[model samples]
Target chain A: MPKSVMHATRAGQPLQPVGRRRFLQVASVATASTALLISGCNKDDDTPSAATVDLGSGDVGVLNYAYALEQLEAAFYAQIIATPYTGISAEEQAYFTSIAKHEAIHRDFFKAAITAAAPGNIIGSLTPDFSSVTFTDRSSVLSTAKTFEDLGVAAYNGAGKLLKNTDYLLLAGKIVSVEARHAAVIRDLINNGDFAADDVVDASTGLDKAMSVDEVLMAAQAFIKEKITATNVGK
Target chain B: MNLFHLISQVEKLDPQAMDQLVSRRNIFTQLAGMSKKAALVAAPLLIGSAFNQVLAGNKDVPAVFNYALLLEYLEEDFYLQALAKPGLIPTGAPMNAIMQIKKHESAHVALLKGALGGAANPRPSSFNFGAAFDNYPTFLAFAQALEDTGVRAYKGKAGEIKEAGNPNDYLTVALQIHSVEARHAAHIRMMRRGAAGGGIMQAGWISNAEANGAPQVVYGPGNPATTFPSEGNTTQAGLNLVTALGTTYTAAEVSEAFDEALDEATVRSIAGPFIVA
Candidate 1:
């Protein structure tokens, strides 16, 4: 559940695939010097220098960022359910189990989408650290869930503009709605109807929170062990 | 509203006369967009023409805005009606939270109206705004469906909305409102659980297609067919979820992983019943 994937380059392609002359150039290089390039294109060669996780720029980076957040959520929910938070009801247990399943589904969806879209360029799964979370306490679990869910929504919101491809944008839109749904549920679980509470939505504007990749990563980095960076995102 | 619907409304006008009401160029531009990019190669110029047509006493670009404005009016009015009725909202957190929701919807209505100015479609004379009973369970049940529908509806037509000049501004506003609708869906679903005497809580997202044995139900039998078909769909960009990710996730989990967009037609149909005479 703590798994994080790191990919090279950015998120999915936004514009139509670089067509015509660019495509021919890439095609020629591929077929012209097959063996030497093939031999050089091994897994070891693909890792970014210094091994720091770089979510590639543009749409792919956004997808990677989303994949990382979903992984964190899946892991957190799994832990709470596995240990069973103190005094957790059978009902609450069932509810969180559903949440855990949903996060896992989301995590796997991104993994599958990224891999299908970028193949070798896809990020590798990441490992997470949860030392600070008090798994035995209901308060801690729900609060953490709230944080993850809200962060997920904000990340998706902020990343929407970065996509040049409407398809990727639409796909991200699909997931962000679910994340918002999760955020509201977790908030209500902690305190009913605090779903779009003042903290998350600006009282004056009434718009829901949206955080840039850098802002979301600041809160996300502590729970994740990877040396993640997002400067190239949307670039 | 969509182009075909708008076109059908203007069928009686002669070409030259209609040009005075709504530009022929702008209508074709909107039609090009609605036809899913048949003429998209001319996008920048098409959009420029569209933008100019809107500003030049035509309701072309504003037609799409009016669609959004109309929906916001529907939602704001629905919430206000619910709040007016006693016993629909339970006391304390749920009620207060819903009140905030109503306010946000109202703000959305106002925001769109301000953006549209004179071009905004007037609100329908009245809305149905119900799944019948005035009890909390009934109110929340309808609220969940409405909000969920709103999310899909926005996503479905976002491409259409993006055509009204600035792609950046239209998309940003649509997404902002989309997430809020999702939040509302979740909270209402959560409250409905309490009203129904909770067992295991439903996942905040729709878990599966109603056709494929989704564990939880979303819309009732009466909702238009497109509503559930879209929600239950698990395909994206020609990739089927279960086929692509089946090894790791169960079929249900695979379905839960992605939300689907309804076509503009489906969106109009979904909102059809709620538009009371």
Candidate 2:
């Protein structure tokens, strides 16, 4: 593998170069006249187009879609740890810190896997604005955590069908379950022992609410200023 | 102009465009002034109706199939590894339960393959079970981890088919598989507590209190101190396990044991390595 790829895998960073040889191949393809011309065309056509990160349609799109969400979560938690919340109990801080580490690991894991499996197709980083959030307040932080976690569960649920890859689906299953746990914990923090209530999960179906890519994008758009689009997502 | 003249002029233009133009003009608004009824009537027509659009375009068979196949590989590999070890499962009832669980996981692999249908990738020659179950402590830990993860995976993906507005056929099959996985988790927790005199384990779970209370005492069957369901009907099926075992254990007690076995940190820790690196 290339040094960059090795470094990325080690550091758990997204957009790792695949390998020296593969990098050359990709570089060659990029520098080739036809490819360059196509790239140029895309750059020039600035007709108020929605900024979208092409996930390459179908199952690939779903994976990239998930990858994008993981990135957001990872970034959020990373920020949380970088600046520890004031007045947080030691136990609570430890718990949240561990969770932040887990999320970061998850984000990087997806990035590495996607890079290895499908190079040149990773979703770009979203510029998140937490202006409305007051991280100092425990309740405010927990409430925000609850919303993100719940949104994650619903988003995963909604995106599952669009996923064509069972491996990705399985991976998603693993991640979402963790997200559910996070949701439950945050819920408990807000209200004693109200973790798995009827509000979050439907009693009859035993399933969380499902939100489509469009729905999630709209919800996430509030925090994210950049226009993130999933190109080549669910075909 | 008179109402008749206005109506005639409106009829001359394209109906759709003309209606929009008139609606925009609010001639009715000018005529009726602050009339709310006109607004209400026009709102429905002016605002387009919402309908579920089925954007069933291209289904990516390779990506979808590969993803499902990977999970099957994980489950299949876990059981294969567990079954390979000799003294992991006790003989008679405990062994039987493990065998059944192994069979169910195998069935899951097969069922998932079937779902993948033709597009399924060829199975990998081998799988790296990683450092999850390096020792007995790790083995139990991994087992708990897998079961918890399996439960979550099912919960997470069950709504996918629903979101696509697809038929419930796929979701039903997936849920059935999910329930089986949960049962396996519950049974494993029972065996871990050395229930049933270390052999011929019953279906009921051993509460943490019971497990920690006495050294040799199995909570169910012969013990009178432990509570079980009476010989009557109840709404919940889980309680029936207690009844079947002839033990007096509350549903909450049984549930707590399951909860204790599947902790969130443990689940995250087990899955974390797999997800990131």
lDDT of 2 by residue, B73-98 (tens): 66667767877888765566545555
Error of 2 at B58 (Å): 24
Clashes, model 2: 26
Judged by whole-model lDDT over C-alpha atoms, candidate 2 comes out at 0.50
lDDT (tens digit, per residue) of candidate 1 on B167-254 = 3255666677788888887777666656546522465777665421111333322134443244656666556766766665566665
TM-score of 2: 0.43
TM-scores for chain A, candidates in order?
A: 0.76, 0.74
lDDT of 1 by residue, A95-159 (tens): 78777877887787788888878776567777675755678877777777887888888888877
- TM of chain B vs. native, candidate 2: 0.50
Residue A21, candidate 2: Cα error in Å is 43
Candidate 1, position B254, lDDT: 57
Off by over 4 Å in 2: A1-52, B1-277
